[model samples]
Target chain A: MTEKKVYNVAIVGATGAVGQKIMKILEEKEFPINKLKLLSSINSAGKELVFNGKTIIVEEAKPESFEGIDIALFSAGGSVSKQLAPEAVKRGAVVVDNTSAYRMAENVPLVVPEVNNEDIQKHNGIIANPNCSTIQMVAGLKPIKDAYGLSRIIVSTYQAVSGAGVNAVNELENQSQQFLNNEELEANILPVKGDKKHYPIAFNALPQIDVFQDNGYTFEEMKMINETKKIMHDPELSVIATCVRLPFFTSHAESVYIEVDKEGVTVEDVWKELRNAEGIILEDDPSTQSYPTPLSAANKEEVFVGRVRKDLDNDKGFHLWIVSDNLLKGAAWNTVQIAQSLIKNNWLQG
Target chain B: MTEKKVYNVAIVGATGAVGQKIMKILEEKEFPINKLKLLSSINSAGKELVFNGKTIIVEEAKPESFEGIDIALFSAGGSVSKQLAPEAVKRGAVVVDNTSAYRMAENVPLVVPEVNNEDIQKHNGIIANPNCSTIQMVAGLKPIKDAYGLSRIIVSTYQAVSGAGVNAVNELENQSQQFLNNEELEANILPVKGDKKHYPIAFNALPQIDVFQDNGYTFEEMKMINETKKIMHDPELSVIATCVRLPFFTSHAESVYIEVDKEGVTVEDVWKELRNAEGIILEDDPSTQSYPTPLSAANKEEVFVGRVRKDLDNDKGFHLWIVSDNLLKGAAWNTVQIAQSLIKNNWLQG
Candidate 1:
């Protein structure tokens, strides 16, 4: 066979934490690329990023920046994606957006390559990357859904501050120091930066992760509710989420309670499926005191799940502990994986 | 009411974080103490502790040290309590043990004053303070349990590092700085110091809190499980615990799912009982985004409960979020409160 032609790639918001992770993943994956364009906000533009030993200048992201690019990875803020994602799509580039912009959109396909790669073929130019929390939950639940059929899911997330943004990461650091020194703590970031009050996260747990929606659920909670149904393609699946931001910086831990449709599914059966599933590393041996911790999964790409047990009274009910790096499996790496899937399936040529 | 005779009180583990807090609480509550005696291990003995504008020399703890003491608050360590609590009791001192030594003993009354103050009178010689996670959970559930009988509880705790000991608190501070400086993290104190391996807790979550038991629960988890039954005085009550140590230094937050014996108990009813309950702050307003956070409750003595909601499909199922400073309501404050209750009820004899 003749050598495959390399495609041009553009990274939106290349200066951001998730954007930088996307760039690193692309290089590590050795994605086929003829031209690599790095784009960022006006404030971050003109900065040079060295990727794969090549110096690339980050230009201001705009509608014109996507010209002649085959794939655009968007990890910028939601507002930036909302403004330029459609423009990039109009310029004949397929967009893998890492924000919550088009995740619930009717036309955009929210794809997790391992769970819903078939959905990518139906995307109308823009593919939405599921929320970091939602992605890991679905990644772990997809195999169970296929085998036993899920009826209800209730998830309470122990999310990291990095999910809010890079500034939040900095806020956690400063507040931690103030707490240790017995100095006055000044909180400016956690439990929704735009919210009226800020609380110190250094020695605390905040039940709210994002701004509250009209439905009494935070935006992050709503994201998990809506995205779970969309990713599973089951509009009738019952899902509820309570998202909390802990002082953790990277990985997100979730206490997930699920009710499977089929009866007689034991904990061992679920463990067998999860252990054999792709992109899942089952770190669940309670006997030997083995389970996934956010610390152990901080830099890892695989979703680690443990603490699997059947609900005491309900035969069909089960509880699972899921943990993964919110930045990796939840955002940047998933975006890059979608791009890889698109190329492997020849869906980008449309 | 002949001038309400003040008793002499001694506090062991005077150099620990819980000891410091106990001193503060004793001062704030204006405990009827004619003399405040501070004691510690030989290593920390001779250190001066300031309380109520006076510095007291911390003497080495021994059976002879409690000769004239009326009440002794012991939080040194389980081993120390196992060795010295009985000795102090034999010397005519009523001991409030904060360690796990006498918590589950048939004769040692485990008391959370707000939940079971009447049980304090049954103490043989020593009273046991419940686990921090268990204290908050029982405090929040006591009012509900009084109003509506309880059936089962499943709790997943997001605990702070201070519960592990002062060294864990210092480790969290140092590791947090290392994370901010982009340096490799060092671990020595988390997930039980005596465990074979240690993990970083700066920006991470550890699934194991205390050491593991044969039944797959950590010792901390078992404490929550066993202490809940003892404190609630319902040994038949089913409880499961998954204790996790987050990077936080003070407050412990728990996601508690409970099945009430009575059906159709609305969230409003639960809120009503909690709002009017003693030593509990009901913070369940979901409209103004008002809820209890660990930061707000860190230094406060009250147990904060919020996010009260009924499970969607189960009429008897309810979920509540509980937060409290483990060092305070969980240990030191609880011990002090027990001592006060004993005196108030004439259970202490000098």
Candidate 2:
């Protein structure tokens, strides 16, 4: 193997929750980086974050911020990414965006390294990360698709409030306290912060995650629907999603029903494939009361799947329960994996 | 129509969560009650419960507690129901059990009132109540089963901890606080209190509810499997369940995948049936962001269902999301409905 050369790395939105996780993941992976740059909004420019025993000061993100930066990771917000991503690309930095800005764009490569690593080479300056729910579903289903072709997916998600950003997390805490104390709750940032009305998420479930689309599906649900087709590269594939926010802090759980193309596939057959697949940890053992849970999957990098079984009547239908830390595999780690793929494939320099 | 005569009613396990809700339902429905007796364990005896502007003192439940009682409602544990239910029946009372003691017994009719109200007339002195999860599933599916035959059912439940009793609710609150403050959490009553190991349910999901059975299904899952057959009166129907306890307090949400025996049935067909079905409120308007959530259904009596769709590839398959207050429709309201049926049908006479 050729000797590795260190490259300059830049993280846009370096002060947010997913941004913080990206910083920690970069340190944990010990990525070969000659220099690190942290960029955020002007209001948060003076904030300090320590990484690799060095205090890094955050700076305002602008086109000039990408000078000499080989890789740019963006997670601030969709609008921020829409404004700064192309600008960073114009400065010769490859962008791995963690927002919906370019995910469905015809030109952007929506990637999950383990599922579609080769798709990274086709990126035109920017690569899109799939939604957290979409990422875990595709990761678990990819192997199944490879073993037996997939035709349909019906998913109901039990999502964490952290996916709405840090403010919603605080709102869950505050509203939960108010509910416990029998005090009136003030709701500002649940369901969708920009939506017309707010619903309390403390000890409750909100069927709406993002804003509602014209089709009656929430933006979050549509993201899973569209992103699954894009990531799996099967527009003909049928998918329906109902995303609900629960009172959890970290991991997202999904009840997924899938129809495979092959016939006579048994639960044993699916379990065998999952046990041997990469980046997947199968914890399904009904005898030992073993299965994946949000708390157990939190802070873990692997996609945990359990409660797998074949449909009782349909020979080809199957059900799975998939869980993963939304911030890690869903956002930060997936972004870093794409960056690593870019470096390995020599796509970053272009 | 002949005049309806008021009958005596008794509530076992009074002062408990479900027992309190039963009292509320009875008061709201203004059920014909010439006398109301409240019975509880010795520890809760002498407690005063206010219903309809009258204070009823809780008496200690015993084998002789049902003497002179006409209609007896039991929400106590299975062991307590096993010991006292037959005694109540022997003393000229019609016992409606909300426990699992005689649910699958040969002679006892497991009733949902809406689904199998006529089956209540076949009860040999005692009528068994189905599991909370099973009750909601059967209620939603019974209508569909009547219009279109059901071949198989696969459900994954997002259950509330309050189903485990009051202590589990307290444990969830305490653990949530400990988790938020980064303090060490101690789980004492979740994932089956009698089991050797306990897992924290706050900010977590426990895959196992109740204890495990010989067939690798938890007792809760087995209850759903066996009870669905008993209530639907279709032993040939295949049912599988994965019961999970979430941090929520009262409502239970289930993702149900079913295969219909008839072909070419669209989602609208099932929706039409549910829209006119009694005891079911169809809250499924996706465009305006209207769907049944646990918070909205927490204190409600109806089983709320939405997100109904047909499987894209399978002509016989469909998916539905069912949500209901476990403490109400799943327990208390169902018990009260049975009581009303008893008096209306004149089955209360010994």
Top TM-score: which candidate number? Answer: 2
* Pairs of residues clashing in candidate 2: none
Give the TM-score comparing model 2 with the true structure, all chains together. 0.92
Q: Model 2, which residues run further than 4 Å from truth?
A: A1-3, A261-269, B1-4, B46-57, B144-152, B236-238, B257-272, B308-319
Q: Looking at model 2, give its docking quality level.
A: medium
List, residue by residue over B193-261, the lDDT tens digit for candidate 1: 887778888888888888877655578878987888988889889887777888877788988888899
Fill in the DockQ of model 2. 0.50
What lDDT tens digits, residue by residue, belong to model 1 across residues A191-272?
Answer: 7888887877776788988887754567887889889899899888988787788887788999888889999998889988
- Chain A TM-score compared with the true chain A, each model in order: 0.98, 0.98
Q: List lDDT for all candidates, in order.
A: 0.87, 0.88
Off by over 4 Å in 1: A42-47, A64-67, A147-149, A177-183, A260-268, A285-289, A309-318, B34-37, B45-57, B64-69, B261-266, B286-289, B310-316
CA-based DockQ, model 1:
0.43
